[model samples]
Target: MSLDMSLEIEGEIPDWEALDNAIRSVGVINYEIDRDYVFQGAFKKSDGYFWLSKRSEAQRKTVIAEGNHGCSFCVYNAIVFRINNFYYDDFVEDMNSFLKKLTSLSSMQFVLSFQYEDVYAVRNKRGFEFFWDQPR
Candidate 1:
């Protein structure tokens, strides 16, 4: 089974080296660098999996209005990961670990959005997806 995963992080500009280190720690099959984004190669266990990481700066005023909840100073981060046949438990565990590491480094709440595709399903509709908004 192959799964595609994308991870986005917003808030607090990350040091490229630090970010790279954190991702490399995942022990994925392959990875590529493109500007501020990183793309990972497919995993045999996750043949159809695709992962993406991206970052964006937030508006300063939105930060002030939201107070600490606003990562205005921190870049707007978002991650989207798509999984094909992997089990939910395994995926969640991996994501939890990644989120923990990100939070520790930024010292600010991080938001997460997860989406999954059903390769076996007959419907063409999008797969399962979930999201959580974190505090600043």
Candidate 2:
């Protein structure tokens, strides 16, 4: 079983340095790239980079994605990141901090969607907040 979190932010993507720093707040990244590491000073969208978290033993990857992506919900014109398969026990807190750090980099609002096991949740700055929703 894996945990996945997606962050959707409006407008242009933040610079790679800022994104790197914010991601490091949760764990140390392995940073695997082959000439695709940076793009116009921002993270190259849809690329997945592997990482290791200090809080968990599991190894995982985080992907910089583009456009709107939610299973049931929708967020448009956003720069997205999909942090995948992190089994940290205190992940919810870490995600909250991650979102806060990202929000600080720019004035754009953020939308976050997370899933673990049977639970799925969405948290956003511009309203549309919801707790766990288990599928029927």
Candidate 3:
């Protein structure tokens, strides 16, 4: 079991430096990003990893074509994190900090799962907005 967090980016594209800083801030390392800025790597804080990727326009269309009618809310770019079920407290603390950092970098739709309960939110210059008192 793991906690999943997805950030759908909006407006300007995030630069590698910003992404690197965010990823490192969460205790992730030895990652690599392609020209498209898609990246994946393990977390130094625990037994988990993350992947950030963007779908091409054609790919998004294909998902729609395949019958995911709600795909409209899905964006071309997203950063997804998979935190392993170990040291839940540490993960929550780290993610709280990471989410706060992200707010200053970009505007995004944030989706997070806590104990299998998912909550949708928006992250902007103001901050991350959602409520989930995850059990430790």
Q: Give the clashing residue pairs of candidate 2, or none.
A: 46-64
Alpha carbon lDDT of each predicted model: 0.40, 0.38, 0.56
* TM-score list, all predictions: 0.48, 0.42, 0.64
Residues 1-136, model 1: lDDT tens digits: 4343433333445444554554455444666656745655533333334455443333322222222221223434434556544455555555544454544454333333223222111100222223322312
> How accurate locally is residue 33 in candidate 2, as Cα lDDT from 0 to 100?
21
What digit string (tens of lDDT, one per residue) describes model 2 on residues 1-136? 4434545444333344555566555554444322344321212222233231121223122222332323333223232234333434344445555555655564444444442222233333443333433321
TM-score ranking, best first: 3, 1, 2
Local distance difference test, candidate 1: 0.40
lDDT, residue 126, model 3: 51
Instruction: Give candidate 3's whole-model lDDT.
Output: 0.56
| Runs with alpha carbons beyond 4 Å of true place in candidate 1 | 1-8, 11-13, 34-36, 42-50, 53-77, 115-136
Number of the top-ranking candidate, with lDDT as the measure: 3
Shift in Å, residue 68, candidate 3: 19
Looking at model 3, report the run of 10 residues with the lowest lDDT sum: 61-70
Clashing pairs in 3: none
lDDT digits (tens) for residues 57-131 of candidate 3: 665421222211222344456667677776666666766666766665645534443322344444534556644
